[model samples]
Structures are given as C-alpha cells and as structure tokens.
Target: MFRFFRWFRDFRRNRNHTLSSSPQPSDKARSPCNQPIVEATPSWKFDSKARWSKEYDLSICHAEDDIIYVENLVSYLELQPHSLRCFLQIRDSVPGGAMSTELCQAVRESHCWILIISPSFLKDPWCWYQMQQALSESPTANGRVIPVRKQLERKDYPQELRFMYGIDVRLDKDNGFLKIKQAILYYLEELCAKDREEQQQRDSENLVDEATPQA
Candidate 1:
C-alpha cells in the first residue's frame, strides 16, 4: 500500500514535469486533455493453473490528442501489485502493419476495451473506427466495453454507448479513475472465477470417466 502511494507521487511529479517541458502540438487532434487504485494481490493471482488467451487486460481506444493522459493512466495501472497489461495502439501495434488489421486484432486480443471519449476522439476517424471494432466484438454491453467520458458534453455522447453507463472524468477525475480500475478488476476476477469453475467441472468429468469400465 505504501509503495503504491509512493509510485503515484513519483508518477504525478514526472507527469507535471513532462507537461511543463514539452511543446504543445499544433494539431488539434494532438492537443492536451484532462482525465486509482486497488492494493491487494487479488485472490485470482493464486490460481496458478488458470490460463487466458487474451494478451491484454485492457485495450485503450483514444484519440492522438489524449495520448498524454492515457499514457499516465496506463502507467498507473501497470504499476506494482496491479501489474495490468494494457494495449495501446501507439505502444503495442506492430510497426508497418495495416491499421485496420491491427485495430481489429487489438480488440479481439484484449479482455476489455476502454474508449476515451473526448472531443478529439469524437472527431478522429481512426478513434471511431476503433470503437466500431470494439463494438463488433460484443455487439452489446456485456461489461467488455468501458466508455470513459473526458471533456465531452452529455449531449455529445455517442448513441452506441448509451446502453452502458460510462465513467465521467470531466468533473471528478480521481473518482472516475478509481471506478475504471474497480470495473476492470471486477471483470478480471469474474473471469478467474469462471475459469476455475470450468476447470473443476472438467476435473470431475475426467474422474467419472476414469471410474467407468472401459468400453
């Protein structure tokens, strides 16, 4: 717990330094935007045999304008104890790969998608494309898609995301980030539970088969 706070403090200090030293981009899409924590080695961590196909716990979909904020959020989640693996196109996408293919693959390989819905995101064609890719993966609100509203008006919210309630960071960023982390943790824990149950069921079936006389 203490380590987590220490890391957060360092993170904030570094963030402020970067913001103060970096030059602002001329492109609107690359502009700045404004955007928590759980301390525990969650029970699921003990499940040594559990396996998941997804490469990432979360896939972040955001406009280029919001990279700084998204980067900070990702940095926090990827810290010690949490150690979450997040998929960010800017960081994880294969070099020279087709944009569409990479976007779809990212959506498919991630357990959850976080849509950073800022004004820039709404205007960016690629951001919307990524959102569409994520939507196609579930086609409904099954907790797989997490819409994070930042600097966006209520009226401007997309119709596609209306079904699932989003985390609004326009006012209370800290609370919103906490909720986002909690939501991701909850989903991951649920997956672990389901995996364990399935494994148990399979074990039982195997035992019964072994007990039966050979055909």
Candidate 2:
C-alpha cells in the first residue's frame, strides 16, 4: 500500500511537470480555456440601397397650395448626397388615376410619411384624410410619420398630431429640412441594423445545420 501511494504521488508530479514544460500560447494569443481567438467580422456597412423593401424613403402628404414648396423640398432630397426617393402625389401619381388610390398607395408604400401641416393643409379635406391614413398605418408612429408645421398657429395644431413631436418650418426652411433629412437617415440606419441582426441569425442557423451530423 505504501509503495502504491508513492507511485501515485510520483505520477501526479511527473504529469504536472510535463504539462508545465509544454509550449502553450500566451493569454494574449489565445482565448480563455486555451481556445483559439477569432476576430469578429464587421457585420454592417452604410449603403444607399432601399431599407426593408420600402418603395420610397419619404411620402409627402400636403395640400395643393403647398405643391410648389413641396416640389422644391423634393428636389433637395432627390439631389446628390441625399438621393432619397420620395413619393409626391402630384408628380409621381399615374395620369388619370383615382386620387384616393394614389394617396393611399403613397402612404402605404413609403417608409416614412411627411405631413406638411400648413394652414391650407389643415383646411384641405384630402390632407386631413391622408394624415389620418398615415396614423392608421403606423399607430405607434415609430419614426414613420413626420409632421412639418409651416405657417401654422399653436391653437391650430392638429389634435391627432399632438402626441408626436414635429418640426416647425414656419421660421427656417433650410434648418427644418436638414432636421427632416437627419431624422429619415437615423430611421433608415436603425432599420439597417435590424436587417443585419436578422441576417446574422440566418447565417448562424445555416452554420449549425451544416455542422449537425446526419442520422
């Protein structure tokens, strides 16, 4: 028994010595538990492609009186560096198409809707209809609706739009438009992040399936 115990102790000591003498990767070169470190690849990049299969980046819902001003805003958005596709009922609508169909499609297909809440807009029945339609499409809002208050009074602010924050362009058109552009870009980036996460999940699932053995 004494000899057996001695042998066991010597074996343990030799094993320890052998392990200590073996060449091992440093902590910096290897992960915890001696696993090889793998550098994570970047999963996303900024691109000009449409986000989430949306047809247009922005849909302008405004009164006929605001068409000229909306056109200028559209031009700014569509120009280089911005290059945002916008749905304008006046400019992009099919010729002889029903007005209701055009308005509904514009609100439905766009990633975001901009309600130009000018005085004329408040008075226009069609503008009010579109505003309600936009709200119905995105009840929680969720960065989908933007209300631009142009030459409108505080008392005249639409009751339905009171819940969400809006940009007031009554004072500075350039500054307001810039803010609008930034908001749209921010929303698009968020959508892109979601898309990337979904893609990563799919890739991981594929890898798991490939590694799984057949019965």
Candidate 3:
C-alpha cells in the first residue's frame, strides 16, 4: 500500500515537471486570429485642383455624451453589414463629447450631418455652427442634411435645416425600437449606395487622367 501511494505521488510530480518544461505560447501566438493593433494614422485625401473637389470621402458630425440615443446611433452604425467609413469628432472618445479642431474640420469636410437635437443640444454653439456650415456647403434647395432628432421640435431645428429631410429618430427612444432601427437602416443603405456611385465616379476620372495627354 505504501509503495502504491509513493508511485502515484511520483507520477503526479513527473506530469507537472513535463508540463512546466513545455514553453508557454505568447499572447499574440496563443490565438490563431490574434492581430497586432494597427495605429490609425490620418491618410488625408482630397482634391486640391478638381473643378469640384470635396474635402472628405464621406464625413459625419455627431454629438455624443450621456445621451443613450447618441451612443445607440453609433452602435447601430458600428454593427452595419456594409461598413460606414466615418469619423465622429468629439472632445473625448471614452467619456464622450468635446468640441475641438477635429470637430470643426469634420463638420466642414462632412457630406453627411447627423444632429442629435436634445434640449441640451440647443444651448451648444458647436452644434449650431456645424448646422450653419452644412447649409452653406449645400449646393441647392434640395440638399442632403440628415437630422436624427433625439428630442426636439421643428422650432428647435436650425431655421435653415428645417426644410431639409429629417429621420425623426425620437421614436427610437419610444415604444418600439425596431421600427426606428429599420428606418435608419433604410436611410443608411441609400447613403451607402450614393457613396459607391461617388467612388465609381472618382475611379473613372482617374482612368481618364491616365489615358489623357500628359505634360
């Protein structure tokens, strides 16, 4: 009986020794899908000399903070089947909204504008300026200005932005979130299609330039 007990102890110690001898995998190698974090450096591209050159591919300006609605909007975009390539300019990324040069630049360069007009949004100057800039940049009466009203009325909307089509996403904060989600998805799909068309147009121009006479 004593010999059997000693044998079991020795076996266990040998198993542990063998396990310890085996090299542990590094964090990156532990998971086959592990990818190194790539730092996002700004690769700015804009037409400096095009007859009609826009500053951005597709820019979107939104205010985010304690508002669940704003966060939800971002969350929905993040989960899209077709990725939305956009930057939301804010003061802080972790806690939320803060106006800066980024916010201003984003507003100026943006093709798409998402205004979350809660009661708190009205008193803010940055949001107001962004709306102004968007209108100024808009080509005609039929301009693309998307409003995501968190909680506000027509009177609350910037006078110039009033005529522009709005998504009235306040319903998302109401009884049914699905209906609101579907509506925004439908709208975003259209935006995605428009971006595709614009991209194709840019590609065609590039091909033409290559084929044309060069000095």
lDDT of each: 0.75, 0.73, 0.48
Q: Name the regions of candidate 3 deviating beyond 4 angstroms.
A: 1-66, 91-100, 139-143, 172-215
Residue 123 displacement (Å), model 2: 0.9
Per-prediction tally of clashes: 0, 0, 1
Please provide, for model 3 over 1-215, each residue's C-alpha lDDT reduced to its tens digit, 9 standing for 90 to 100: 64564466446544644553354444213211232222122212212232123333234444445245554444333332322233444312212224454466565654455566666677777677776676677645433456566557767776665665665654533322233334434444455556667878999999999999988
Candidate 2, after superposition: displacement of residue 118 in Å? 1.1
TM for candidate 3 is: 0.49
lDDT of 1 by residue, 1-215 (tens): 64564466446645654554444333212212222233655645524333256767889999999998898777656554455667778766665667898789788888889999999999999999999989998897778899999988999999999989899986663636667777887778777778888888999999999999998
Task: Using lDDT, rank the candidates from best to worst.
Answer: 1, 2, 3
lDDT of 1 at 117: 97
lDDT of 2 at 174: 66
Candidate 2: RMSD over Cα atoms?
25.7
lDDT of 3 at 189: 45
